[model samples]
Target: MPVAIPLTTHDLNSGGFAAARARTTARMTATVMDLTREIPNIRAYALRTWHEATQRLAEDPEATTAIRAERDRF
Candidate 1:
């Protein structure tokens, strides 16, 4: 995931530190809640799917050959 670009708020600059802090804190809470959910994360599902596809191709000679030929030209 792409992280948000943080705005610098040095003491010398008149930036809205309070608003920035509040926004960051709120986003952190929301992200943490999402992390705790049981739904499959992006990595896990992708790994599982990749493994299944690989195993299928390995077991089937035709598929394995076709995939190899496609990748050879890819």
Candidate 2:
């Protein structure tokens, strides 16, 4: 089966913005495509957190902040 590529839509209210909006929409589409490639890894990290650590973090916010800081560098 052939996979479908996602397309982002843009709407312009005034003709004055037609040129700028096109450039912006192109940049947005490219960024979205790049970010989407990391969805699986992001999902895995989110799930792994709740496995049990979520409860511990709920038990304490300080430790959670430290862990979050480390993850930000990851």
Question: Top model by lDDT, which number?
Answer: 2
Assess the local accuracy of residue 55 in candidate 1 as a C-alpha lDDT between 0 and 100: 65
Clashing pairs in 2: none
Give candidate 1's whole-model lDDT: 0.68
Per-residue lDDT tens digits for candidate 2, residues 16-46, read: 4777778899999999998899899988977
Cα lDDT of model 1 by residue, 7-68, tens digit: 56565245577678888999999998898783568667766766666666667758766567
TM-scores of the models, in the given order? 0.41, 0.44
Q: Can you list the residue pairs that collide in candidate 1?
A: none
Candidate 1: list runs displaced more than 4 Å.
1-16, 36-40, 61-74
| Candidate 1 TM-score, C-alpha based | 0.41
Which candidate leads in TM-score? 2
